[model samples]
Target: MRRLASFFLALYLASCSGPYMGKDLFGADEFVLDSYKIREGKLSILEMEGYSVAELGDEDLEEYQDRIHEDDVLRIFLYHPKRHDIVQAVSEIGNSIGYQVVGGEISLPDISSVKVEGLTLGEAKKKIEDHYARHIQDMEVFVTYKDRIVRKVELAGLVSVPSVPVDGKIRLFDVLSKARVPTDANLFKSYVARDGALLPVDLNRLLKEGDMSQNIVMRGGDKIYIAEPSAASLMVMGEVARERVISLPSGFMSLRHALAEAGGIPFTGDRSYIQVIRGNICKPKIYTLSWEHVIHLPNDSLLLMPGDIVFVAAKPITEWNRFISQLLPAFGGIEFIGKQCGSWGIFVP
Candidate 1:
């Protein structure tokens, strides 16, 4: 029952959606759109996409209402063509009361205080509505901060394209298309980083699985770094000095270099052979490379890619049995043995 409960809990945690999962787990800095903080007063709750809001108190709400237009970047979007007069009136009201249009335009109101800058047609309507909601009596306002533009972006692991810029309006597809991402950019294993933390993101799931909800919208000043193909390499479970993720430097690195980076081999490691397992398919390609050959022979250096698992297996059972036999006599005595094993046994066992 305990195991079953744990299984369900694990499944539930694993199945959580991107946003519900803690933000700390996402690596939006690298092709991730999760790290952006919308400057306050710029856009209303309805306008910003892909963000869940925190609770707002009445005092905060009142302050938001009192804020001047310049305090935030307004995005107004207009729908009806016949509402030019409303837009005109809204512009006049905004200008009369120290409200400036950073972007977008309305029918020329004779107000000299406010200037219309870079607003889209939809953004224009939103600005007009916002003006009415705050200052004008019996006026209506409607604004939204939906992703209005899309641009290209790209990601390369350590050896390839490592920098992915997220500026203006960008889509996930645009980012991947920007640079020649290596084949090792695993869709499932990829992550995003932001604010000095790592967050998990599904690159393969987003691209191949077509999960529209995870198709994040990019904002300005966002960054994404594709981890080095060697950085995400798998550990050799059966043997190897250190069973951990090994990050390789950029450039033409080889398989032998990876083994060296992982502290070479343990004293118990089999010096005769090392193996690499590729892919999860039925017929996993298994390659044998000699430690001496890999170190000295230039032709034996095979370039390691991301997610490759290298194993430097332990010596054969026959050798382990011999070693055990050599220690059997030492284990039989109960008195002198205890003295000899005192600190050594405590540390080892």
Candidate 2:
């Protein structure tokens, strides 16, 4: 009789200990949740407004023309009313095909090598025209830029293609579209690194607002980096049906939306005290909001920042009852094991 009573006592103690043991093993401290807070003033969404592309002026054209570099290929077309023979001769020598600029100079048959390296398209055409004018009258010279060899930019981060070969004048948006910016790209945080200077580029403004001013003209050796959105997120924990990390879209998020996305609070949770914990583990700011108050007063809705923790506290009586209910199953299992051990003549103190 004493052995049977002792066995029952041990089983009772084991059942009661299960909840505390589980708590110790799986305490809040056991799991190291992310505590990195999104610093204030570190992130901001760009204001979207309509904008227009500025008209390219003569100065812009002049600047673009000045970008001609060595090793570029130029096509020279010559037409003469009386000098068909000369034209034929030049075409035979491949000068009519294309002139490859080498060391700022181009070698033409029967004409002295001209230094057209640092010259604009107009200046280069004039030099070639002057050369042909000395030999043939009524010679029309048309210089067409064939291929560029020097100007190139490197695009990295959040783009499909990393290395982009730029041939002519291009803007920031042009390359981004051509390279295929990912949908999740943090365009507001994109930047251009040029000549040891980091220039902040708001691609969101350029795309949504049509802000052409934010569209910077790309240059040779420029490095463009479009970053992914910050990993800072809000977490819904404690008594929620689905505990999850809510990613803030465009750095803006609300408490109500986060809770809804987390599958809402369970019946056991205390809706009256929904806690929003902000800041790091060492220093946390806990703000409590009443669901009842928020429902009645829309203005009472809280805006949640990244790295905030929304914990729906559980009702004390409900949680205790839940713990006891979970322990009952273990007690029943232990009781069965005790009876089987006694039947097998296993010693019980």
Give the alpha carbon lDDT tens digit for every residue of 1-349 in model 1.
5875586457544543211122322121221121121111112211233234343223311211112222343333333355567566654554454232344333323223233344443555455555554544444444433223322233435324544555444555566656555666543335444344433344554555565444455433345665544444455443556666665322123666667667777766776657665444354445555576566655223554444567675665534555556555645664465667784764322
Model 1: which ten-residue window has the lowest total lDDT? 31-40
Global lDDT scores for all candidate models = 0.45, 0.64
Q: Candidate 1 — which residues are off by over 4 angstroms?
A: 1-94, 97-231, 237-253, 266-268, 281-283, 297-301, 314-349
lDDT of 2 by residue, 291-310 (tens): 76445533213456656788
For candidate 2, list the clashing residue pairs, or say none.
none
Q: Estimated TM-score per prediction?
A: 0.33, 0.52
Q: Which regions of candidate 2 are displaced past 4 Å?
A: 1-66, 76-98, 103-119, 123-142, 150-199, 208-213, 218-234, 272-308, 322-349
Residue 96 lDDT in model 1? 51
TM-score of predicted model 2? 0.52
